[model samples]
Target: MPACEITIEKIDFEEPIHIVRITGALDAYSFPDFEIKVRDIFEKSGRNIILDFGKLDYISSAGLGALMGFAKIARQNNGDLIILKPTPKIGSIIDVLGLSKFIKVFWDEKTALNSFVSKAG
Candidate 1:
């Protein structure tokens, strides 16, 4: 049997932005863990964020709820959240939910990260 695992990690950027890379399934069982980790990081930094979904395999409604919660928190702090490298399946899910209207999606990390600078005052 294969070892089942889900992982999330935070990588700090230069300033006012951070990347949260998530991998594996993000269903109800794992959403809370991902939510907690992300919330804790945001509570401390409260900066712009990039959610890197390059390696993420799946997500359920609970996972989407968790992401919405984090988006609210980011917005409350005047920070923005973007997503990067989502697979077509995930991208379609996001589109169906109309989340793409509120959250920007990028095909590359550099472009996603650069948006903050270009849009800055």
Candidate 2:
């Protein structure tokens, strides 16, 4: 198990999006904590979320499954889970799994934030 850190930051956008920065490796070992923190945030407000993968080094199938679960919950509440600035390796994995079809990925933070507004309008 590698060092995994999940930090949740509230971005001051017009709609108030939550940016969850994932660092290090996200595998089965760390998925539990990640899921708890994210679910707590979602339960509090059910706001749109952006998973910032800029510092994330790796992810496993279990990690992806957790994300898919989050995405489903967000959608049910009229919110969404977006992926921001994924590393090339992580990006490839996500693409290969066709996760992009359900979760939107953005290269830029501003773009990802705007997507929430665009969808609401």
Candidate 3:
């Protein structure tokens, strides 16, 4: 089995949104690490954030909880947290949980980023 690992890749976008691309399995074992990175991002800069999950392999309930937590924090800061390129598995979970009503999921980074820009402007 592959060891659970989560990596945050920074993206350079023209808008004021901060894109954090997360790649790897986001399981219970990796939730803490994931939370730390997400918390830091929200704490340091309250920017409209897009979480690109194109390369993410897996995610558990704990991982979803982390995302929800970040979403709540982002909302409190008057920012939004969106997901980009989530695998079908992850997308389905979000859909089932009714989170799709709160967060929008996009197929690509550009669309996700554009939505943020549109909302901000």
Candidate 3 whole-model C-alpha lDDT, 0 to 1: 0.76
TM-score of each: 0.84, 0.93, 0.85
* Arranged by TM-score, best first: 2, 3, 1
Off by over 4 Å in 1: 1-14
Q: Write the per-residue lDDT of candidate 2 for residues 34-103, one digit (tens) a residue.
A: 8898888888885699999999998988789778989999999888999999999999999999999988
Question: Which regions of candidate 2 fall more than 4 Å away from where they truly are?
Answer: none
Q: What is the lDDT of residue 45 in candidate 3?
A: 80
- At residue 73, what lDDT does model 2 achieve? 91
Provide the lowest-lDDT 10-residue window in model 1: 1-10
Question: Which lDDT values do the candidates have, in the order given?
Answer: 0.77, 0.89, 0.76
Comparing 1 and 2 on lDDT, the stronger one: 2
Off by over 4 Å in 3: 4-15
Name the candidate, 1 or 2, with the larger TM-score value: 2
Residue 57 error, candidate 3, Å: 1.5
Deviation in Å, model 1, residue 11 alpha carbon: 6.1
Residue-wise C-alpha lDDT for candidate 3, range 3-106, written one tens digit per residue: 55555555555545677766677776777777787787777785578888888888887678667778888888888899998889888888999888877799
User: Could you give me the TM-score of model 2 versus the true structure?
Assistant: 0.93
Clash totals for all models, in order? Answer: 0, 0, 0
